[model samples]
Target: MGSMDRGLRALVGIGLIAWGVTAQNWWGAIGIIPLFTAAIGWCPAYLPFGLSSCKTPK
Candidate 1:
């Protein structure tokens, strides 16, 4: 994924985890999805649509 996409995902994941921790809820587990994807720079959800956030090489 592109830098912007990765950064946004990481931010969102961190936010969710923080919210979950503060609230002491299991929902915080959901944050792993975005966090993992961001770390790997890949999102499985984007596969079927053939979408990509990374810029193409010139």
Candidate 2:
């Protein structure tokens, strides 16, 4: 993913995890998906929709 996209994903993931941790809810664990995507620079959900922020290699 692009820098901005990665940053946003990281932020959101952290936010979700924090919220989940604080609330002690399973929903917070869902943040792992975005965190993994941010770390890997790939979003599986975006694949089905044909969406991407990463730049193509020349």
Candidate 3:
């Protein structure tokens, strides 16, 4: 969830979205949604479990 992680996540999300749209597959778009969460540095999927890879020095 650091800056780099956020950036990478955003990039990956964009890629997924593009692929999804180009492939005309709704499932692909659905898959990209998680990338958006990661890009924002806040994952709902991880929230419940309190998981994070951020290096903010606690």
Top-TM-score structure, candidate number: 1
- Which candidate achieves the best lDDT against the true structure? 1
Per-residue CA lDDT of model 2 for 1-58, tens digit only, reads 7999999989999999999999999999989888889999888888889988977889
Which sections of candidate 1 miss by over 4 Å?
none
Off by over 4 Å in 3: none
Instruction: Select the stronger candidate by lDDT from 1 and 3.
Output: 1
RMSD after CA superposition, every candidate:
0.7, 1.9, 2.4
Q: Between 1 and 3, whose TM-score is larger?
A: 1
Query: Tens digit of lDDT per residue, candidate 1, span 1-58?
Result: 8999999999999999999999999999799889999999999999999999999999
How many residue pairs clash in all the candidates, one count each? 0, 0, 0
Q: What C-alpha lDDT values do all the predictions have? A: 0.95, 0.91, 0.73
Q: Model 3 — which ten-residue stretch has the worst lDDT? A: 31-40
Write down the TM-score of every candidate. Answer: 0.94, 0.82, 0.62
Query: What digit string (tens of lDDT, one per residue) describes model 3 on residues 18-55?
Result: 88889998756764775877655676677788877777
